[model samples]
Target: MQNQTETYMRRALELAKRGAGHVSPNPMVGCVIVKDGRIIGEGWHEYCGGLHAERNALKNCTEDPAGADLYVTLEPCCHWGRTPPCTDAILEKRIGRVFVGCLDANPLVAGKGAQILRDAGIPVETGICEDECRRLNEVFFHYITNKTPYVVLKYAMTLDGKIAAYTGDSRWVTGEAARRHVHETRAQLSGIMVGVGTVLTDDPLLTCRIEGGRNPYRIICDSHARTPLDCQLIRTAHEIDTVIAVTEWNERAAALKKAGAHLVLCQAKNDKVDLTDLMHQLGAHGLDSILLEGGAELAFAALEAGIVHKVQAYIAPKLIGGAAAKTPLGGTGFAKMADAMPLKNVTVTPLGEDFLIEGVL
Candidate 1:
């Protein structure tokens, strides 16, 4: 028989998915209330500054739940921020037991919630499906530890490993399914980033078009402030957030600023934008997860800086080989094969005619 802890934790994980694209700088959490082996209530963190998972679940539980067990994907928050402390709610409800999938890494709540429950004479069991729970809030974990947004580098390439043709024509490399999948990905992250080369060549709007997906903030790494003022991103900046990362001030800075782009100035090395500085700035702005779609140079820089936590590559079956074709990564690549990046816990899924390869580095 499946462990009851696992069953309830899995349900909580599913519930947490509803909060994607809405919770930023805060971990996604889900709660399930079970009484006499039957679920009585469920809830998830919906958005920033909104009611948390525990409170939401308690609100939905209309029955007498004094002896019910609560299953939570993440540790219940013990300190107050946007709302009341979840620990206090659990105490008042007289919950009989608690199952925690993972401990909260935030300094304010780290293991304190579980301690409070135990001190209140309530039984608390932790580490149920711990790895899965941590993976779900990987960006929040990274931010709490490193003070930077978790970076994910994603791109679509051909069988020959080229991102663009020699002539820079890359409208549709992957199938429609893969493209739709990319839109879903964009909707889940806090921001989408690309280099100036991609912005100039592709003129992408970088908005989420999926039915239920939310558009993330768009970011451009343009060292010289060269983003065209008339581009789609510039034109739509007033409606959505757009950030322009530049290494030096240029003549077009005032014009781009007037176009509603927030300019972030960072130092340049070898006449290139410093990826590390950009990441720090992004973290300070409360972006806990960032998706990097690139024109090669940016991907290589992120990889070189050791900041890319995950990589998603969509590979089409067709072959397009040319000496000048742009590859997915560009920079001073490693000199030896042993120095190449290694991926673990890899997953390969077929998306229509293309294959989606994803893993952690």
Candidate 2:
């Protein structure tokens, strides 16, 4: 029975991923109905303000789901949201048993969903594939629990940790596969951020280019509102959500605002926009997570503020040796090796000629 529960929970997790890029500020939940050791129905949360996974699965069941085992990646919601409570559907279906991947971190539901089923005489088993379920909704969980946005710092560099040549030429630092992967990742997160230097140099559009992929907000860390009015981000600001984090509302800031940019004033740290304040501000705007695609200085400032929760380092196989070459992290680092930040739960994946190393900070 334990093995069967895990099997169904794994399937639920897989289905939940289908909701990526569609659900934000809401968890991507998947549900499966099973009876007599055979699968009967399966569905995932399709979009924000849409029917939940449990309802979709129950509604789509070809046969009667009454007295069947129900497995869901998240605890079926018990409180009213944009849609009706998932617990209502599960109870109405008269499910025999319930298997949950993890209890929702949301205070409105949390453990209440499972308890509601238990109160109704339904046996509910939780914590099946719990870690995977939590990781799947890390952004939502962080935002709901911390009242701030989850931050991921991503950068591409050579094996020697150099992001650019001695002459500051950084074109094609990583292979095409790595770049494509970054674009796909951007689609999942709520926003992508970079420093003014990146805008001034690369003039990147920062929109998700994949067909059918949702575009994330383009956020620039320009303390003085120095983002060029003619840059790609400014040019497309009317089309895509563009935000400029500034320390003051000067003429430059007003000009960018007039040029279709959204401006947020954040406290300055190290004479740059303070990322902690920026995350909280963005969170208030309903952004659950941000992908920090940076120039080294902004990356370093974010890390120093202890706001960067995750890191994705794409390392090219080739070497670019130069003392003057730029590294992925700038600013004055820790005073000693022992003071350096370390990553946990690290993972490495090969991406063509480059490798991706990711971990929680």
Candidate 3:
């Protein structure tokens, strides 16, 4: 029974990953129902405000769902949104046993889903293949627990740890493969954010150049009036949508609004923009995960605030040795080694000539 449960859990995790970008406001959930040691049905949540995992699984079932054992990647949602509570659906299906991979972290659903099933006189088991399930929905879990979006820090740098050469002429530091990977990352996120410094220096379009999915929201963090009006990011409306975040005191916010950019005025802390408040605002706007594409100062601020949850470094094999050539975050560096953040479960992969390193914060 344990091995069968593991197999179903693994399959559910695979399906959940496929629904990453599409499932927003709703955590990606996968479900499978088996009876008499035979697989009966399988389903995954495909989009926001859609049928939940249990309902999809039941829909796929050809035979009577009664007495079946249901296995779900995450705890079934208990609250009503666009769809009915999944706990009620499970009860109505008369599933004899339920095996949940991980508990839903949303305050509204957390333990309530499991409790609902239990109260319905159905057998309930949770935390099956727990680690894998939690990892699959890390973004959702982070948001629910921390009240902020999970920040994925992504950047490209040379072997010598430089993002650009001495002159900051960093048109393209990484190879085609790494750049394409960045696009893929952008596509997965609800939004991609950069500092005004990066806008001034690179004037990047900041859109998903990749082919798979829709472009994410492009966000720029500018405080004290740094982003220039003539920046290409403002001029182009090609593939992506753009939003500019400025402090309430910035006189340039109105101009940016006039230029057809979504402007968010947030509070500043210690002369720097308050990223925490910015993240909550994005969350309220239904963005659960954000990719922080950097220039150093923004990355450092996010890192210092303990808001960055993942870091992806694309390391190219070249040396541009100098203080000026070093990577952006390395500029001011961490204030102290004690302040240096630690990451766990680091994974490194090679993407063409560059290396992709990712880890949890």
Candidate 4:
């Protein structure tokens, strides 16, 4: 039974992966229903504002789901939102047994969803294939439980560990395929954050220029009010909403606001702004996930604070041997190798000229 449960849970994870770019604001969920020790039906959440995993599985089952065993990759959502509460739906279906991979970390649904099922007399088992399940929704879980954004440290560096030429003229490091892949990633996240260094150096618009999907929030971490008002990211309001994080008493706060920027004032630490606090502020504003596009220092801070949950890197097939040229994160690497907390489970795959790495805390 344990092996069967593992197999089914893995399938559910694969289902969740299928809808990666399409589901936002809604965590991708996968579910399976088994009866008499046999798989009966399976389904995954298709998109935002759509039916959840439990409902999708129930609809797929031809038999009466009453007394059947239901297995889900994530905790059944109990809150009332775009769709009905999944816990109630499971009760109505008369599922007698429930196996969950991980608890939903959203403060509103965390333990309450599981409790609701127990109250209805459904036998519940949790933590089966737990690590894999969390890996599937790492971004969502990290934001909800940690009160910080999930950081994906994306960088294109040479095999010798240099991100750009000595002159810092890294106009395009990775192939076109990889660059396009980055755009797809931008479309999936709720927000894409970078430091002022990236804004001043790259002057990136930071919008999704891929074939489909809406643009994500453009966030800039400007500690000393260095980002210029005329930067492409700030000027392109129609393409994406932009947010600037500044020190609590920054004099440029009003100027940034006058330039039509949403400014978040946060406490400073070590003469730099605290990214974790800024992330919490974004969460309060309803941001569920964020992608950290690098300037190095911000990425290092996110990792140092134990806030980065995943990393995606595009390795270009060249070798620029300058030690001063930045690596993935900007400043001195992680304080110590021990300071880097190990992800419970990690999965890596090749995506054209890049590599896709997903991990969980």
Candidate 5:
């Protein structure tokens, strides 16, 4: 019975992921209604302001959900915001038992949803695959708990740690497989961040470029607002979302706005844009997560700011050794190996010829 419950909860988690890149500031939730050891209905959060998973599952069921068991990835929300309390729906549906993957980290519903069910005399069991469920909504949890955006630092470098050649030709550092995975990641996050230097040097479009995948909000961390009006991002700003983050507004910032870019001023420290301030601004603007695709300097600043939550480093098998070549991170690095930052929950994957190392910072 325990193994079967885990299997059902795993299915719920998979369904929850179907809402990836669509719901932000709201956790992805999936619900299943089961009766007599058979699945009756399954549903997941579809969008930001649409129906929630529990209510959708109750409404989608073919057979009678009354006196049946209900499983949900996250605790059903008990407060009224965009919709009424999900507890009301669960009670009305007459669910005999409830299985929850994890209690919500949201202060509003922390344990109230389960308490409500318990008060109504339904057996509610939580913490089924609890760790997996919590990690699945890390972005939403971080936003609710810290009121800041979760940042992931992503970069491609040679085996020798060089991000680019001596001439700064960084194109195709990783293989086609790794590039495809990057596009997939861009689709999952709410924002894709890069320094203005990356725009000027690579002239990258920064779009998802994958079929049926939506492009994230393109954010350029330009201290002086030096993003070119002719850049592809500026050209397509009207069609796709683009933001220019700057420390001070100038004529060039006005020109970029006139060219259809949205300009935001961030706090400055040490004569440069403060990455922490930039992250808070992004969070307040409704971006729950940011993928920091960088030009070494920005990556280092993000790390130094202590705002980077995850790292994705794609290491090519070939070596490009040169003192003049750029590495994944630059600026005043830690003076000693003992003072360097460490990662947890690290995993290494082989992407064609390149190796992708991912870890929590």
Candidate 6:
């Protein structure tokens, strides 16, 4: 049986996920207040520039919390930002003890919040469900510490490692269940990106159709401003946020901007948008995690740029082999086997008629 603190922390993790797609650049945090061996208050950080989980939880307490135990998914923020420091709220509430799932990776609060509580004579216990907490906030950790968004490259391919047939007939490559799973996964990230080739060929809406999942920002890497103005993404740009990264400002730029698509003029190197510069620009947009759902060229570009942190590939059982068939990855792949990218912590699971393979890059 788990201890009360561990159980409370696990519940906090569950609550934290509720803020997904809403809280970006900021980690999802959940808090629970326990009094008399019962949960009296619980809350989560719902959005940016909003009350943090600690303050939200404190606000919901009906009884005095002077001697109550507080369990939080991440360490309480100690520095001031859009809102007051969470540590101050904890002190104001007179929380006696705190159980933290993981230490925040943000330099502003890393180990400092816990120290503040300890100095106030409050008992602070750290590292309860730490791995779960780390995975939950890895995007925020990567963004804050590395100054870049966490990238997950996703694609669907047949058993013979072909993404599309010779005629480029890529529709319905995966089963309905796997497609639904992709939509659900997209709902959790901050944005989805595709190249001009994919936009021209697939014209995907890139919206999350799963229930209770918000649509993420849509990014199109159209170096020459070639994305059709009447495309589904541009047509619906006024409805959801869309970003077009281009190498040169052309006549079509005005139309795209007028269509409510944010234009990012990026310099091209070797006739390709600089992946490093694009990632930095995305960080400026407050995107902590992004899904790479583009064609093989984009996937290879991201992987070669060493920006891909994870890969989620859905493999169907069928084999669509052809000499002109498109593979899942392109570009100059590793010439030597030893130079290939390695994945760790790989997990394979069946999803309907497809198999989902997820691994850390």
Ranking by TM-score: 2, 1, 5, 6, 3, 4
Please, what are the lDDT tens digits per residue for candidate 5 over residues 204-296?
A: 788997887879999999999888888899999999999998889899999999988888898898888888888888888888888999878
RMSD of each predicted structure: 1.4, 1.0, 2.3, 3.4, 1.4, 2.1
C-alpha positional error of residue 227 in candidate 2 after TM-score superposition, expressed in Å: 1.1
Q: Residue 112 of model 2: what lDDT?
A: 95
Worst 10 residues of 2 by lDDT: 268-277
Query: What is the C-alpha lDDT profile of model 3 across 17-85, one tens digit per residue?
Result: 777778875688888888888778988998887788789889999788899999899998888888989
TM-score of each: 0.97, 0.98, 0.91, 0.82, 0.96, 0.93
Per residue, candidate 2 scores C-alpha lDDT tens digits across 218-319 of 999999988999999999999999999999989999999999999999998778888888888999999998999888888988888888999999999989
After aligning candidate 4 to the native by TM-score, how far in Å is the CA of 119 from where it should be? 5.1
TM-score of 1: 0.97
In model 4, the runs with Cα more than 4 Å from the true position are 18-26, 34-41, 47-49, 79-82, 106-121, 248-255, 304-306, 332-348, 353-361
Q: Residue 24 CA error for candidate 5 (Å)?
A: 1.7
Worst lDDT run of 10 residues, candidate 6, spans 1-10
Local error of candidate 5 at 91, Å? 0.8
Please estimate how well model 3 matches the true structure, expressed as its whole-model Cα lDDT.
0.83
Off by over 4 Å in 3: 237-240, 248-251, 335-338
lDDT of 1 by residue, 65-135 (tens): 79999999999999979898999999999999999999999999899999999999999999989999999
Candidate 5 ranges with C-alpha deviation above 4 Å: none
Q: Candidate 1: minimum summed lDDT over ten consecutive residues — where?
A: 1-10
| Model 2, runs deviating above 4 Å | none
TM-score of 3: 0.91
